[model samples]
Target: SQKIEQNSEALNIQEGKTATLTCNYTNYSPAYLQWYRQDPGRGPVFLLLIRENEKEKRKERLKVTFDTTLKQSLFHITASQPADSATYLCAPDPNSGYALNFGKGTSLLVTP
Candidate 1:
């Protein structure tokens, strides 16, 4: 069985600072890992995806890293703002064969 784990607690950070989030998985080696940001009452917005062969990926102020050996992925928000506050979800696709199952997500609160 494949399982994804993320910090269930809310992460609070001051605006203009960098925020880091972690996602861990067990029982599977995924071909790629994806990160998404979800606002209240809305679907998650795709952020970044890093493949197994790739070490890191970045888009705008977002960055993601994939480590197959550790079975983990790290998500970072550089120079975060209050508007960047949202629940971030991680989905690890096993061999790109099965459906994408997202984790419970870790909420980020960027305050002024």
Candidate 2:
């Protein structure tokens, strides 16, 4: 069986700093990785995706890096603000013809 792991602790960062989160998996090689942001009660909003063959992907103030060999993925948010606060989730698609399996998300709080 495959498993995904993320930091259980909530992260607190000052506004305008970069926030980094981590996700790790085992027992499977996914075809792609997807990231999302979830507020207190809302569904997750898609952030970015990185293919197995791709090393990194980026959007405006966000960046994601996938290392297949290491079985790890890192998510980054640059110039983070209070509005960026949310729980970040990672889903890795195992290419097993099933839907994405999401990991326990890490919470981030950007304080002013």
Candidate 3:
């Protein structure tokens, strides 16, 4: 079966530092990749997305790199802060009509 999973632990870091998160998978191939940010009890907010054929993608304060060879995705947040703290999710396009299958998620906690 196909599977996807994120850190599933809180990543605590100091403000102004680069925060790195990871997503791993197994048993299936995805068509595209997406990243989302979620605060406690809130639905995920779309961040960045990269297709399987793409190398890397970025937004103002975010970057996402996908390596199909490794079947992994990396997420980065620069200039972090407590306000930036939230759970990050990695979603791969399941190739089904809906096009999304999300990993559990990784929590980010940036200290002042």
How well is each residue in 2-100 modelled by candidate 3, as lDDT tens digits? 899899777999999999999998875887889999999889999988998888888988889999899999999999878999999998878667747
Q: By summed lDDT, which 10 consecutive residues of candidate 3 come out lowest?
A: 92-101
Q: What is the TM-score of each candidate against the true structure?
A: 0.95, 0.96, 0.93
Error of 1 at 52 (Å): 0.7
Clashing pairs in 3: none
lDDT at position 47, candidate 2? 95
Q: Which stretches of candidate 2 lie over 4 Å from their true place?
A: none
What is the C-alpha lDDT profile of model 2 across 1-112, one tens digit per residue?
Answer: 7899999999999999999999999987888999999999899999999999899999999999999999999999999999999999999987788768799999999999
RMSD of each: 1.0, 0.8, 1.2
The residue-level lDDT of candidate 3 at 34 comes to 90
Estimate candidate 2's alpha-carbon lDDT, on a 0 to 1 scale: 0.94
lDDT of 2 at 102: 91
Decide which is better by TM-score, 2 or 3: 2
Clashing pairs in model 2? none
lDDT of each model, Cα atoms only?
0.93, 0.94, 0.89
Better of 1 and 2 by lDDT: 2
